[model samples]
Target chain A: MVGGGQLARMTHEAGIPLGIRFKLLSDTPQDSAAQVVNDVVVGDYRDLDTLREFARGCDVITFDHEHVPTEHLRALEADGIPVRPGPDALVHAHDKGVMRARLDAIGVPCPRHRIVSDPADAVAFAAEAGGFPVILKTVRGGYDGKGVWVVRSEDEAAEPFRAGVPVLAEEKVDFVRELAANVVRSPSGQAVSYPVVESQQVNGVCDTVIAPAPNLPEELAGQAQELALRIAEELGVVGHLAVELFETADGRILVNELAMRPHNSGHWTQDGAMTSQFANHVRAVLDLPLGDPRPRVKWTVMANVLGGDYPDMYQGYLHCMARDPQLKIHMYGKDVKPGRKVGHVNTYGDDLDDVRERARHAADYLRGTITE
Target chain B: MVGGGQLARMTHEAGIPLGIRFKLLSDTPQDSAAQVVNDVVVGDYRDLDTLREFARGCDVITFDHEHVPTEHLRALEADGIPVRPGPDALVHAHDKGVMRARLDAIGVPCPRHRIVSDPADAVAFAAEAGGFPVILKTVRGGYDGKGVWVVRSEDEAAEPFRAGVPVLAEEKVDFVRELAANVVRSPSGQAVSYPVVESQQVNGVCDTVIAPAPNLPEELAGQAQELALRIAEELGVVGHLAVELFETADGRILVNELAMRPHNSGHWTQDGAMTSQFANHVRAVLDLPLGDPRPRVKWTVMANVLGGDYPDMYQGYLHCMARDPQLKIHMYGKDVKPGRKVGHVNTYGDDLDDVRERARHAADYLRGTITE
Candidate 1:
C-alpha cells in the first residue's frame, strides 16, 4: 500500500485476519499505518527509485490514496509490478475534469460540467448550464472540501485559477440529499456493490453516513448500485471504488465524484456489512474472490470523529462506552488537531433513529463537541 | 502486557481503537504481539530488572498469560506498578491446587480431587474417589494438553512427577460435554458475563466453541454465568476470567479450570458479541466501564485453525472467503507448525447448525485439514 493515512491504517487492520503482510511506502514513520504495519518504507512515493524498492517482494501494489503520479504507477507496471486499479482507471480519480469528461462520454448521469481555462470560460460555462451559484473545483490535488468553491459570481470563480491548476465549473446540484454507491472489483472481472448510502456533510466534510439511503425507493437504489458496478467494470478498477452522488429533488441521481481507495462514505461497512470495504479491497487487489456486500443489520450509521480540543479521547471513552455499549469505536493513531478526522464510530441496529443517535452521540463525545 | 502471544496480539488490536498505548514485554521480536506493537521490550519477563524497566511508563501492567511468576508480579506491585488481576487472583490460575482449594472453600462444585506428593498418593486418592482412570495435572506452567495425563495406574501416574512440579489428582468425571463461562471485571466492581459456551476439545486443545451452548437448559446456563461472576468477584479479578466447566451426564456443573486472560473458548466473541473479550479485557484493566456482552446474533461458532502441513495459509483464504463470505478469520502472525494454534474463524447467524458448519469448514480449509 502507498500512503500511510487512516485508510491504510484500517486496511492494515483488515488484512491481519487474512494473513496479508502489508508493505507500506509511507512518508514518515509517524504516519497512521506506519505505526502498525511491520514492513514499511519511509520514502516519497513519487520517486521512481523509492517506488521500485518498495514494490520489491510485494505481490501487488495497491494504494491508500490516488495522489501518486500516473507516470510513476506506469513505471511500476513496466517493471512487472501489478499496480492495482491501474493508472488508466486511477487517472479519473486524480483529476476531476477527466472524471467528469469520462462519465459524460459514457452517458453516466452527472451535472452539466465543463473544463474552463479562465474566469471568463467558467462564467460562460455556468451561463450555458444554469446561472450563478455554480460549483468551481480544481481538477487535481483536492480533498475534504479543499480546492473546491461555490461561486455565485465571476470574481469568486477566479479564485481557483490562482493556484495555476486546471479548473472545472459545474451547475450546483440541487439535491435533496447526498448518496454514495461503493463497490469493489478484481482484475478477473469479479465485482460487488454495497448498498447505496445517504451521506451527511458538514462544512463540506463527510460527517455521517446512513446505509441503504433511508426511505430511498428500491428501483433507485438498484439503479445506483448498477451504475457503480458498471463504472467499475468499464474502468477496469481492481480495488474499492466509491461513487459519490447527488440525489436531486427531481428523483434523479447525478455522479458527484469518485475515489479509487476506501472512502469515508463507506465507513459504515466496517461494522454493518458482511464484508468491509477495506477487507474486500485486499481481496480484490489480491484477485481473491470478493466477499458479500450485503448489510448485516437493518440500519447502520457511521459518524466521523474529528480531532477536538480534548487531546486525549481515551478519557471520554468512559462516558461514551458506558452510555452506548454497542458502539464500535475506531481511532487512527494520530495526535488530536482541531477539525482533523481522528477516528469514527459505528452503530447498527433494527431502528435507524436509535442507531443514528448512538453513533452521533459517540462521535460527538469523542470529539469533545458534546459534554453530556 | 506481560507476555507476547496471540491473546496479546488481539488485545493490542482491541486497544488501538481505544487509543491505548501498549508497552509489551516480549521474550523475542518474533512473538505474535511483538510483531505489531510499537513499544516493545525484548527481555525475559522473569527478570526483575527487565520487568521493572518495562513497567516504568505503563499506567497498568496486565498479562497475556498467567505464567508470570507470582513474586515478579508482587515486586512490581510493591513498586507501585498496578498489576491488573493482581498476584492474589493470578495465583489461582498459576496453580491448580490453589484454584481447586479456593473454589472448594467457596462452595464451588468440582470433581473429587487431591494434591498428591507422589504416585502412591495419587493412587490412594483415585481409589477413595472411585477407581482407575483419574486425571493428573501439574500445579503450574501447564497449557493445552501439556503437563496433564490420564493415569490408569501408579506407573502411569508417575509421569508428571518427573517434572518435579507439584501434582494434583482428580477423579475423571464422565461428562456429556464441556462449557465455559467468560467474564470481565473492572477494579471499580463493574463486570459483564458473556453467554456460556460449549467447548469441544480434541487432544485437550480447544477445537471449537458454540456460544450459548446449543441445547443447554436455560437454568443450567444461568447457574454457570452466576458461578463465573461470583468467582470473579470473590477472586477480586480485574480482567478477563474464564471458568472452564464440565456438564456431567447427571445434570450438574463442575468447575474444571480457570484462566485469568482471554481464553480460546471466548474467541467467538470477537465477531459474535457486542464487545469482544479482548476489548473488554483492555477496558477492565484500564479501569474503564465495561461494554455489553450480549450476542449480536442467535448463534456463533469459533473453530481454531491448527497449523497443518501447508506453510502458506493465505493461499487457502480465497476459497474459504468466497465459500463463506460472513466468516471472520483471525490469524496470529506465526509460522506453520503441526498442531500449533495459528488462527481461528468466527461465524454467526440465526441458525446454529449453519453457523457451526461455516465456521468449521473455513477453519479446516485454512488448516489444510480438508480440501475441496
Candidate 2:
C-alpha cells in the first residue's frame, strides 16, 4: 500500500489474520502504518522512482490516501504492477471537476456545477447555479474542508481561484443531512455494498456516523445503494469506494463527493458488520471473494476522537473501557495534533438512541481529556 | 510478548488499535508473530541475555505460551520489568504437578492424581487410582497431547519415564465431552468470563469448538465460569486463563488442564463474542479494564485447519470465502507442516446447526486442499 496513514494501518491489521505479507510504502518512518507494518519502505509516493522501488516484490499495490500523482500510478501500471482502482478510475477521486463531468456523463444525480477557469467564470457559473452562497472547490488536493470555500460574492470567489487548480463551482444544495454509501468491488467485477449511513461532519471533518441511517425511507436507501454500486461498476473501481451524498428534504439523494478508499463513514463496520470494510477492502484488492457486508446489529454508531493533544490516551482509554464494557475503541498511532483525527469509538446495540449516546459520550470523554 | 506464536500474533493485532507498540521476542524471524510485528527481536527466548535485551524499554511483558523458563521470568521481574502472570502465577501453568498440587490446596475439583517417581511408582499409582489405563504426563514442556500417554499396562507405563522428566500419573476419567472456561483478569483484580465452550479433539489435538456448549445445563455452566474466575483470582493470573475441563458420565465437570494464555477453545470468541480473548488478554497484561465477554450471536463454531502441506492456501481461502461469506478465517503465518495447525475458521448465526456446518465445511475445504 502507498501512503502510510490510519486507513492503511487499519487495513493492514485486517489482513494480518489472512497470513499475507503487507508491504507498506510510507513517506516517513514515523507514518501511522509504518509504526505497525513489518516490511515498510520509507520513500516518497510522489516520486516515480520511489514508487517503482516500493513496488518491487509486491503482488499488488493499493493506497491509504489518493494523493499519489496520477501519472506516477500510470507509470507503475506500465511496469506491470497491479494497482487496484487503476489510475483511470482513481482520477475520478482525485479531481472534483473530472468527477462531476463523469457523473454528468453517466447520468448520476449531482449538484449543479461546472469547471471555472477564473474568478469571473466562477461568478458566472454561481449566477447560473443559484445567486450566492455557492460552494467553490479546487479541482484537486482538497480534503476535510481545506481548499473549499462558500462564496457569497465575487470577492469571495477570487479566493478559490488563488488555489491555482481549476475551480469547480457548485450550488450549495439545501440538504437535510449527509449520507455515505460504502461499497467494495473486486477486480473480477464482484461487489458488495454496506448499508447507507448518516454522517455528521464537524467543520467538514467526519464527527459521527450512524449505520442504516435512522428512519431512512426503505426505498430511498435501496436506491442509494444501487446508485453507489452503479458508480463503482461504472468507474471500474476495484477496492473500497465511499460515495458521499446529499439527502435533500424532498427525500432524494445526490452525489456530493467520492473517496476511492475506506472512509470514516464505514468505520462502524469494524465492530458492527458481518465483515468489516477494511477486511473487504483487502479481499477486494487481492481479487479474492468478498465477505458479507450486512450489519450484525440493529444499530451501530462510530464517533471520531479528534485530537486534543491525546492527553494521556491510556487514561482516557481506561475510562471508556471501564464505563462501556462493550465499546470498541480504535486509536491510530499518530502524533496527535489538535483538530486532527486521532482515533474512533464504535457502539452497537438494539437501541439506536442508546448506541448513539454511548458512542458520543466515549468520543467526547476521550477528546475532553486533551483540554483537561 | 515472550514467545512469538499465534497467540502473540493475534494479541499484537488487537493492541494496534490501542496505538500501543507491540514488540515480539521470537526464536526466528519466521516465527508467526515476528512475521507481522514491526519491532521483533529475533533470538532464543531461553537465553537470559536475549530475553533481557528484548524486555528492555518494554513497559510490561506477557506470553504467547507457558514454556518460558520460570527462573528467567523472575530475573525480568528483578530487573523491574512487570511480568504479567508473574513467575509465581505462571509456574502452575508450566508444570502439571504444580498445577495439580495448587488446585488440590484450593479445593478445586480435579482427577485422582500423584507424582509417580518411576514405572514402579506408576504401577502403584495406577493400582491406587482405579488400576490400569491411567494417564501419565511429563511434569513440564508438554502441549497439544505431547509428553502425555494413556498407559494400559506396566510396559506402556515404562515409556513415559524415558523422557527424563518427572512424571505425573492420574486416573483416566471417562468423560462425556470436553469443555473450557476462558477468563481474563487485570492486575487490579478486574476480571471477565466468556461463556463455556465445548472442545473436540482429533488425535489429541483440538479440532473444533462450539461456544456456549450446546445443551449445557445453565447451572453447570455458571459453576464452571465461577470455578475458572476463582482459579484466576487465586492464582493471581493477570492475563487470560483457559481452564480445560472434562464433563464426566456422572454429570459433573472436573479440571483437566490449565493454560495461561489464549487457548484453542477460546478461538471461537474472535468472531462470536462482544470482546475477543486476544483483545482481553492484551488489555489484562497492560492492566487496562476488561471488556465485556458476552456472545453477540446465538451460536458460533470454530474448526481448526490442521495442515497437510497447506496445498494452495489461497485457492482454499478463495473457495471457503466464496462459499460462506460470513466465515472468519484466521491463519497464523507459519510454514505448513503435516498435522500442524495452520489456521482456523469461525462461523456464527442464530442456528447452531447451520453455524457448525458452515464452520466445518470451510475448515474441511481448506484442509482437503493439502491432501488433494
Return the clash pairs for model 1, or none: none
Which candidate tops DockQ? 2
lDDT of 1 by residue, B1-372 (tens): 989899998888777777666788999988888887767789998899999998998899999988889999999999999999999999999999999999999999999998999999998988898898999999999999898899999999889999999998988999999999999999999999999999999999999999989999999999999999999999999999999999999999999999999999999998888899999999999999998999988999999999999998988887887787777889998999999999999999998889988988888899898997
The digit string of per-residue lDDT tens for model 1 on A22-63 reads: 788999999888887767789998899999998989889999
Could you give the interface RMSD of each candidate, to one decimal?
1.7, 0.7
For each of the candidates, give the backbone clash count: 0, 0
List model 2 lDDT by residue over A175-279, tens digit each. Answer: 999999999999999999999999999898999999989889999999999999999999999999999999999988999999999989999999999999999
Error of 1 at B301 (Å): 0.9
Docking class of 2: high
Q: In model 1, where do residues sit more than 4 Å from their true spots?
A: none
Could you give the fnat of all candidates in order?
A: 0.62, 0.82
Per-residue lDDT tens digits for candidate 2, residues B254-307, read: 999999998899999999999999999999999889999999999999999887
- lDDT, candidate 2, at B24: 89
